[model samples]
Target: MQFRSIAMAIGMTALIGATLLAPVTAAEDVPPAPLPSQSLAPLVEKTAPSVVNIFAQKVIRNRSATRYLDGSAFWRLFRDTLLFGYGQDRFESSLGSGVIVAANGVVVTNYHVIEAASGILVALPGGQVYSARVLVSDQRTDLAVLQIEAGGAALPSIAFGDSDRLKAGDRVIAIGNPFGLGQTVTSGIVSATARTSFGVGDFRFFIQTDAAINPGNSGGALIAMDGTLVGINTAIFSTSGGSQGLGFAIPSNMARVMVDGAVKGQTLVRPWIGLSSRTVVPQIAELLGLSSLHGVLVTDVFKGGPADSAGLQPGDVILAIDEFPVDDPQALRYRIATRAAGSTVQLTLERDGEFHKIAVSLQLPPNEPARNESWMPNLSPLRGARVASLSPAFADEIGADSGISGVVVLEVRIGAGAYRLGLREGDIIRDIDGRPVRTVDDLLTFRTTPFKSSRITLERAGSVLTATRN
Candidate 1:
């Protein structure tokens, strides 16, 4: 019996060996299925060439140096010899990234990237470099478009994706020159959408991502899995100026507007919805009888404006814009801003426990008075100040009460008497020397015919203060 058991074991071992040595089938020769991965390799390969490193150079004035002789040739020679003239003018350079969005080498980046740059150099992959010119920039949205002569080279361009379709947990990739390092890519998931309260831009609805965005990542491309541009990586919320897993990107929808405007050689004239609103908190939503706490509470609507003309009530809760959910006022602004002027949009709102859809025609923002500003260099209490006639749009843009109309101080130079006396930019001159002042001319008249160091009552950021030059 023992001999028989040993014979069976030997036979079993031989059978296993024969099975292992047998010719593998074509299916067996095929590699095992790849492990599931969040790899962005394929997407990066398709999009990385479109990302470029931007080096901007600017000359800035240095004010800390002592003047040997004010405005004299002798002082200039002495200063140049002693300080190498570095104190008078200092050269500054900024580093950022941009993405080519057109085959003709049209690039898009953050406005701050080339805000004051006198010269811009774009370095593409494979070491090719080219000079870039600013096509257009919109500071309100912090977006800039650049045009580069590619010397007949067909540049790779990135396509814009639907940022409005993004949701939390969606994978994203950020490609840029982090810390001046040439072209690095980082991956993370979208943490939130329509995020507001950043206090950075005028219309602030940003896409929050956990991608490792650092200093030089500004103006870089945030790409979706389909190899499309979802947003422009802009700012990071970091205490150490490094990646803390909190990054913000301007939505591609907004960036698209700037690019379209750049192509048309015109500024993006966004249609205004003419409404001021606040995000609906859970308590507010509950009190309003909303099925879910996911909407914006309209606080005020401009009279004779689009919302008013559409019969929108002040207490209405804006649920969505053409099926896109509106969770905050910023979201509503973003939706309207992205649409063209004269285009009609449907606003889904909840009013008095009933949901209603209203159609509103987008209109150009109110024609505020031109800031054709005049400087007051020789006038007291107004010296070193730039004043403009404040209109509804200007006041609204500056976060002032739209009903308040007066000559608003645009700037007050440091060390000026006005600055010393608590006068500042955005200070609306309610009255000067107890005289009612409503325009820049009124303030100029008051300053020219000054009677006893001007006494001024100004409204600044909702607070009224009396400033006396005497």
Candidate 2:
């Protein structure tokens, strides 16, 4: 019985194989699918010339060595006589990449690459090197513009592409000097867009990709298949300090704003909409009857601001800006900040179960109540700290709550009393010894008064803390 069953199964397999092997007629033969084009050489040839290698050097003076030897006369004499400046000075250097955005040698790179650099050199293709100077450096965006003299020659440059059109699974090529090797190209698809969870910079919006970005790739060009610049490679997520197929780039739209401001010799100021917002969570979405958790829920709107002028109220859900959907507060902020100050944008919002579009004119944050910046006296507990009156403009500049009013610490001198007391920049002085501190004058008055075991209340970021100085 077993032999009979095995024979039947074998006979069935043989019959199916015979039918598959039967010859096909002309009408039944379909054309073979064309092979996918595998080579990216054409795109590389057109875009590689615009990418350049950046070399920056910083000189470090060992002031701590001199300061440490100040109390020891014998050690100072012996060091000056025998050591011969061994610990006095040194040189630090770093390597990175940049993209040429203009034909006349306007280059754009990461601000962190050339930060505090005493000198910078840009090396183009064909072994031509030129001294580059920074036109502007914006730390918030981690972008910088550099200028180099081409001497009447037109250099190859890459034009900016619309990053908003980029979608997940789109092909991208990263051109950079990874590991200080020559210009290297790595290809991958965009893993995600509008990524805001990373703490790379103040502006958290980033384009996440799976490209092989390693050290020395910062400020390089992330190019699309159409040979246009889409993003600037800035950071990577890895535990080994190398590429793990997780890289982040600053979108070209934001980079364009920095380049435009640098070329026009203007300061980089982002447009502000006076609204305190939070991400729309699942609970809030269900409570508000939203179909999907997409958009930011406004909590408060500042008076006399662009949103208020446009009649935007709390509990309104901002869905999009000019038809571009914003998934969270960071995306909304990024969309608004990339536009110019005087331009107008149409915001699509949901209010009372109805979607409405309103035009809001963008503007710089107001600088009402002039910031009379003052430094505290040397003998005071707040000594070596610079205090300024908090206005909308200053508060926005320092990443504080724009609606809050008080005096804020702008800077704290190292090794000073304020620094020792753990007072830092961006700390809003709310009250001093039970007295409400509203302005710099009030802070100065408090600093001048003598009080034993004084307690001070301050607000930092969003948390309130109390500090005491006896």
**By lDDT, who's the top model here?**
2
Encode model 2's per-residue lDDT on 208-232: one tens digit a residue.
Answer: 9998999999999999999999999
TM-score, candidate number 1? 0.77
Candidate 1 lDDT, 1-470, residue by residue in tens: 99999999999999999999998789867889889985678889999999999999998976544444554777667778976774587789999999999999999999999999999999998699999999987787888999997787889999999999999999999999999978999999999998887877777789999999999999999999999999999999989978999999999999898888788888656677777677888888778777888888886676778888999877899999999988876677788779888899998989998989999998777756565577876745568888887665776566554444578888889988667888788888878767877677776676544355667888865457888776
In angstroms, how far off is 71's CA in candidate 2? 13
Question: What is the overall TM-score of model 2 with all chains considered together?
Answer: 0.81
Model 1 clashes, total count: 0
Candidate 2 C-alpha error for residue 61, in Å: 2.3
Provide the clash count, candidate 2: 0
Clashing pairs in 1: none
After TM-score superposition, the amount by which residue 184's alpha carbon in candidate 1 deviates from its true location, in angstroms, is 0.9
| Model 2 CA deviation exceeding 4 Å by range | 1-36, 65-81, 282-292, 375-386, 401-404, 411-424, 429-438, 442-459, 462-470
Off by over 4 Å in 1: 1-39, 63-68, 280-294, 368-387, 392-424, 427-470
